[model samples]
Target: MVRATLGESSTSASVLCRSDKINWQARNKPTIYPKNFDLTDAERIGHPKQTNNGIYFGIRMGTVYGRLADIHNATFEYLRPQGGAEEPWRIGDFRGYNQAARITPIASELSTEIQCQAEQAFACRIVHNTNNNGGINLDEILTFMRQSGMDTFSLANAYPCLMLTRKGGTTHAVRALKCWDTRDVTPLYHNGAWHERYYIGMERGTLGDAAQLLPTTNGSWPLTVSVFLAGVLAGDHFDLHNWCLTNDGNPAWVLPQAIGLYDACGKSATYTVFDDSPSGGNESIWRVYVASLTQISTGIRFVINSNRNTSSTTYQLFVDVAGCGSNSKTFTMPQYSSTNLDFTWNELRMGPPAPAAGSTYNIRMQIHSMSGTSATTLWWEGQKTITIQ
Candidate 1:
């Protein structure tokens, strides 16, 4: 197979190409083979096949990049709803759309299901794109698949066999489908490693090796951030405002949701944190003050989910409206009682007479401190709503 890469094959630079860095006049070097292939045979009484380095059954599946994309908390979710993570899988492909989830005790210690996108990812057999862009070394991958008579790409020459064996941390082997179908995917988290029970025919295909490591391809470790969305089409528009994240449970100051999609509730999104900081240390959240040219901005309201600790906690929650009569309004969080632990809603008003719709207005929010000692926590940003017109 003939493959081409300029200067250095550090990474598939097609995604973030530098026009001037193109070594168009560079000489054709060597077709260095991939090092990650771990192919085996059906245990013939004799030796291995003489062709393609004894890779008689299958070729190494180059690389797959992924992470949990944004997850919407269904309206029915009363406890820990939104998936908690900053969305590390933001690469522009289906692999990046891989899911993630959290497993937390809701009311009892029953170990409920948080089926992270990862668990469901391998279970459902997610299909990977064969497009060689972004350094995936498609030339080599395609060559092996085609030569082995396993290449079943579509008419457009894109979607090929979604089946491949992973090598590194875990070696996952899923059965190949005669054709692709999204609706047929099922949720299977029975075990961490799910391999095909029966390989090709009624009998088994090939069993994998115990533990092997062969580093091949131009792909790097801790992969590049590739964003993805399953349903969003080839050229669909997913506005930045659609991802209204308040906090990713990081130690840094929370930035204001600029194009934040919000209502009376705090933010459209939220993540979980058990005081990622020092135990018992205090934590604070912020909403940088902002002024609108033509809109009325009211104060914010705080809503507590059912999963909050029974041992009542306090947050010195306050809001600052730049142009309002009472520029500052503080609402101390009331403790949770047996009767009030479920839906505790409190308001921090800007002493309203309503800002004129066409007039200018500015607003801000601050949580002086929220005790981070408890394992069962509440994120102020996600639970509160900002009222603005």
Candidate 2:
């Protein structure tokens, strides 16, 4: 974790080191010890090892400089931990670097499936409410889920997570989780406290505490209605152009399908040219407007998924070059409507014709409906610009 920052105005003299001189110095520092050890039967029975403290490790941050001479060719050092089992089941090594730096010991338990099931249950509640109108209000959902053995329910904490405004002053709290497999959602609620709750696993899904928040719900909150698909980079740059609709009975804007380029921070960096045509209008088409040259990271991610398409009808994705003309480079996305789909493409290729570094373009899409017009709801393009990391 040694950060070497080089400024544009910095000169060679600004560096902390000088002339590569050799120096070995030791100060009066106290010695440190490893805290982990084996537990004997007597120690476990009489004075049981407290698991609350848990095990610990150390991290040393330093700078390595070139030496004047070599040390006996290349000597190898074999280091091993004491008082630990040698088997992989008891101990193992994990390492990740660069964009995917991560490490975890076997002691860590994985709750992805459990939490996913919880998230699915929560989503089902919303789907039920959407299908049955206001029949399943926010309060009823909270109470029922709590009674059903939920410790907590995580909600999105962003703009749409403000359940108060959407519920018309209802006393409850609710928000939606933007899923990679489903539409970016906007749940409802109000007057909710921020803390750990039992009965449900909500302690794992708290907004800001668990995940990001979204905007409020749309009108009527129809369950058996259209599905809104919103596309985003990583953090917050929402795509503004080209949205898709399906018969989910949910509000039109519940899930918005946006289009835009983003930087490393998941912030919108490129202008997402959106086809802002009215939903369900016959023969209406829209295109995203890339206004200027925007610097997007090399591995810009383009995600596409189905949102709130509760109906049994099949849905698909199609891309077309709308800026230059009606029929330029028309490309349809592969069948991406199985539950939810994630598609990543080169924004440069998807950019306007003859795109340059730090430039912009307009790309449009058509979420093909199997039968007739099911009903369109959300539509957004390059509304927000992703911040470069």
Candidate 3:
């Protein structure tokens, strides 16, 4: 029977035999030397492996654990960042994008307009002498007009005992003109003037069907008043067969020359022009005569003579003396002394009051010059009448 002997002092038996070294054993267990072989130390190997001589190994393991702890801390910080440069974060900057992802924030804008209500207060403000019974106040009117963008306007100064206010100064608040209306004042309600009023009623199809009265200031005596009449208001789009502009006569006390019409918007629409004559020389008169009523159903006339005479003349029909519809007329006269040519009911026939579109009214006028002086020229400027429907 062969038996093996273990070594003590950590010297193998085979090594001891070859080198002739001393060997030792503890209860037949092999022993390792401190320098050549190491026994596991529980302090260094963490409790399970307990042995002596573990200080040096404990130191080496402690160093490795420290390095591992540092690496773990760094790896944890890098994976789950906090806030520093090494742990960068995007909080609010990237949060808004979440809402954008749900829906696009782009949309078309709807158009709208502002409109004024009827109950909205008008710009005109009014003030009067509470002490005096309500009377015509100039200051109030002036202030209202000024606030309404009429800065360079003047009220009638003749009404001395009046309070007129106007918009002036930097702020331009309505102010009193400091005039006293101690006496009862009656506003002139008529006599065409700039801003004057006239009351007249005429048949719709008659000359009064289209009329333009003057503006009414104090609603009274004739003054320089410009007038315009139409289905639309000033600065409005033009309408068909409805617009007349006329002026009242001046203070010269002369009835304006009456105007007659051939169509609602006739080709020869007459417009009077007034010359600012010192003596009101000749009320400048211009008339647009319908040379031919071809391709027209209506004739219009605009006369601006004086502000006090806002009137219009419209003809519903035109009839000749031949009692028939003829395109031309001619006559040779022996003399001329205010020739009188009248058309009786039987001698003349009238057409429709309103002609159809493209209908024509051909007028032929013939006059003879009797005054012989190497072909003397005669001026025919007078009222000529024609029967109309």
Candidate 4:
């Protein structure tokens, strides 16, 4: 029987007729050689395959990975790309995408604000940089705060003074409950930065609310002695209201049974209480208002005048200390009450008393009228001026 034989280092077999060559070598094959009939078919195929042996000849996922951008821009299998020169394969650099950073890194920020009457709010921010590409979003963004290793923010968990320590330098720790929740997110754009914000609010975490009032040298803020001293050692900073701001005046009519009644229908009113108790009189009040003035004076004085008078009247006057009373001093308007046309330049003066100086009153002007009686109405008419003397 005749059988096919392969050369194996291999010695050759002689043949009287033509024979077909089949390459069967599995190893140690040269990649480039001359094309000639003298070589075996296996050797010829190896050299031909080597000349065209790049990714273009044959492609598999194990060898080359084609991208969607490349396929999207592809034209035909056997020509230049679909986009011509401009449309290169968008596998990588072809799409013009920056490889520096696909997703921007996020930075955090925190700030504090003092509202009216020592209220407080802390603001937090998450910033995304576009590398100066300049883009903005006007949509309201409310991001809940995320911090590692701390209590989660909630409506019932807005702690004001939970942690007032330092984060670094003057930066206080951002542990406010408002910053932790979605309740305080602020959606605002400013200075061309892309960012989202969160807020932390506390009612009483400010220095003024938490710390005791310490007397300060400048005293610009507190402006009182109690702000400097604590406990029961000193008086209140605002309790005195001035020095003190109060006043009381009493006018006693000596007619034990005298009653003044006037009515179209004869409705009457009576006052006989001052008859038995002449010291007890009709009390009138006046208030002395002071604003931001705290200077002390030596003493207070009183000066008054009248242009004309009709009837006679006598009364006693006295000063009031704080809310307490003082003894009365009597006086009479004899010259001024001579007639209804008593238009004389008669003036009465009192006070500047006791060489007492440098006293500050909190808030009142008090006068006590001990005794007086009149059958008709009395009027003191003049161009009057009263001032601190």
TM-score, one value per model: 0.23, 0.22, 0.15, 0.16
lDDT of 2 at 261: 13
Mind sharing the TM-score for model 4? 0.16
lDDT of 2 by residue, 1-389 (tens): 10122122323321211111101111111111222233222221111122221111111111111210110111211112222232111111101112121211001111111111111111111121222211212233334333444313322121121111112221222222333223333222222522111011122243332222112222131111111112221222222221111111322232221111111111122223331233774211222121122333442323432222133444344343334332212123333232222222343244333344454444454343444434232122233233323
lDDT of 1 by residue, 1-389 (tens): 01122234445323212223332111111111221221121211011232322221112221221211111111111111011131111112112111121111011111111111111111111222223122222234334445555534211222111122222223322222111112111111112422111101001112224112111222221211111112111212221211211122312321111000101111112222111222453212211111111122343332322122123445443344454432222333433211111111122233345533444334343333345632222223211223345
Candidates sorted by lDDT, descending order? 2, 1, 4, 3
Worst 10-residue lDDT window, candidate 2: 22-31
- Return the top candidate by lDDT: 2
Which candidate tops TM-score?
Answer: 1
lDDT for model 1, on a 0 to 1 scale? 0.22
Separately for all candidates shown, the number of backbone clashes (residues 3 or more apart, or on different chains) is 15, 67, 52, 11
Candidate scoring better on TM-score of 3 and 4: 4
lDDT of 4 at 359: 34
lDDT of 4 by residue, 1-389 (tens): 11122222322222201112211111111112333223342332222232222111011001101221111111211111222232222221112212121111222323221222222323333333334221111010001111221113221211121123221112112121222222322122323432243333333323332322211122222211000000111132212111111111212211111111111111012111100111453111111110011212433333321111123445333323342233333455442221111111111122333222443333222222233332222111111122332
Give per-residue lDDT, candidate 4, residue 94.
Answer: 12
